[model samples]
Target: MAAREYGQYCGLTQALELVGERWALLIVRDLLVGPRRYGELAAGLPRIPTNILAARLKELQAAGIIRRAPRSRIVIYELTPYGHELEPVVLALGAWGFKAMGDPRDEQIITPDSMTMALRTAFRPEVAVTLPATAYGARFGPAELVVRVDGSTLDVTRGDGPVDVAFAAGPDIRRIISGELAPDRAIATGVVEVLRGRGELLDRFASTFHLAA
Candidate 1:
């Protein structure tokens, strides 16, 4: 085989070389939530130019990180099982970014997607709480999510329903987990609300899983 022009490197370096560009990680982050059409991805990432987005998607697909699926005469981008595995890595990076750069209140705006990622990242397998089957709702930006917490994991779907716990946060989930806001006070000020279910369970859930120093 002929020598490669990009130079030879180990797996990690090669992986980074494919995705090290700015906005590339964010592209992966958007796909983490769910499959999206080209327009949807482009809409979500306003900072990314159309041609660049197209090229990056092509690169990722070529590298086997994402796959293209045809739906309704349009192509949608979805992460492969291998690509799905990167969710934790992306979440960890997000958490690290939050910690290294102190919270800026003015800049703290939680979105539904962010909330879902935060929930997954903050989840503690050790803290097992049996959630009621009751439905719950939370609103972030133009999106409303129905959250169902079962055992150690949580399931969140789009739309509103009668949720056991209805909570809203003005700050990013990382800041909330980092103790910037007293969880109790959040409830008091209506920043967080537990509409149903055992309120004590919510408190215990917070204590057991919140990301502490």
Candidate 2:
């Protein structure tokens, strides 16, 4: 429950009361990726204060959005079945916000979970289904991911692997994804670097994962 009530009878109001506190939705975002131990959550959300993390966890559990469970002999937090329903809402929010994300600030950094959600948000399933399967090792700043696309399914995981193409880029890669810059031009401008394998595959990657700016 929220610390304070809006004293209104509305679904949105009730939803806000449940998870409108600062950092609450972000906590839900990380949990949407997978169950995370306390330390793992804290590491992913580097800016969250320890006391605040604890408080949010308690509030979420009390609201039945998340639950505590023992995993591998340690306690981890995971979203409940009802909480899993927020995935579409989060993805829509990500796509909506992408339009306003022009450039990242110096202090802004990407995390694996965030990158995962971003890719999921922008993935074009119909286009992907018409293309050949491909795997890419993508490095966005410090976040590394092995992205695989088979038909309409997209899977993103951490670490490197045998990929058709490997590329590194910073936030500027958004231009390529948004089709604002051609993959060839992005490479020429140093906005994207083809680290290994066939660089042409990057065009395929751009088509597979895209969101108009």
Instruction: Name the top TM-score candidate.
Output: 2
lDDT (Cα) of model 1: 0.67
The models' CA-based lDDT, in order, is 0.67, 0.92
Against the hidden reference, what TM-scores do the models get? 0.79, 0.97
lDDT tens digits, residues 1-213, model 1?
111334757776666776776677878887888898998888777667888898888888887889999989888999999888888888888766656756546644555565666666666655546443344465654557886666666787877776666655455434446766666776776666565554444454464346653
**TM-score, model 1 to reference:** 0.79
Error of 2 at 47 (Å): 0.8
Kindly give the number of clashing pairs for every candidate.
Answer: 3, 0
The residue pairs in collision within model 1 are 135-162, 135-163, 136-163
User: Pairs clashing in candidate 2?
Assistant: none
Which residue window of length 10 is worst by lDDT in model 2? 170-179
Return the lDDT, model 1, position 4. Answer: 30
Q: After aligning candidate 1 to the native by TM-score, how far in Å is the CA of 33 from where it should be?
A: 1.7
